[model samples]
Target: MKYLFNLPDFPDSSFVMQITFWTGKQILFKNDALVEQSGEKGKPFLIPDGNGKVVKAYPKPSLPDFAPILIINGEKHRIVAKLPWYQLVLALLPLLLLYGGALGGGAGAIAAMLNMQVFRNEDSAAVKYFKVIGITVAAFAVYFLLVTAIYSVIA
Candidate 1:
């Protein structure tokens, strides 16, 4: 999924920012042309402005708040518009189920993948629900498999 945001307006400038979900690729465009891009996620990268002056850009995490931030030149900007309530539920759903224990860690990893996709806007409501449910089931399967393996080893 991709999230797009309009950069703060500048004189004779038509800068639009594009961010790809999961991979966290950020691209800056001016006048509908690609100017700069970076694949750094949760890290800073430099891009040249319309004036040919370099500015810093960083991609922040996409969880808990569901508000992914893209900081440019010491200013904060949201890459995605509109935070859906379902995203919040998906982000916190794993926490409610997987808390503490070895099995929890394995399940939590699966949940993390789900959390990543949950933020993507491309999926329909029904599709998103199925993803959440499927991931939850996969987590349980991992937990059970781990338990069975551990039990057999102990026996």
Candidate 2:
């Protein structure tokens, strides 16, 4: 997802933001360009400016009512836009539907929706589709077995 904000205080300073995922993947985006990235999963690292100063990037801070904050050039800029929770729910809806006994085309459709939301930009089209199919099938099998076991016990 992309975030846009107006930094009125520091209008001339170029900004870079680094997002460190839970898997320790760091994606660095400076303005519109990706400056650096790491695919290896481990501890998160700091994003350093060209002059060797570390830019502070926080995913979530304790400061109430503040979004993700980026400290660049000693100024804090709040990221105004964020991925909506409903979008996240939409992405995970397929797995939830599978648990609720929806299968077949319904599951596939939901999985497609999820793939569009979650993997569209990150992975190639073929890989995204393959992951969607795998996830949908796995979800269906697990949920079907769970339902069958429950039915067997009740019957």
The best candidate in terms of lDDT:
1
TM-score winner among the candidates?
A: 1
RMSD of 2: 9.3
Using alpha carbons, what is the TM-score of model 2? 0.36
lDDT of all predictions, in order shown? Answer: 0.63, 0.49
Candidate 1: clashing pairs of residues: none
- Give the total clashing residue pairs for model 1: 0
The clash count of every prediction, one per candidate, is: 0, 0
lDDT of 2 at 97: 60
lDDT of 2 by residue, 30-103 (tens): 55556543233422224545577654443434232123555544565566544455434434545456336454
Model 1: CA > 4 A from native: 1-5, 9-43, 62-68
Clashing pairs in 2: none
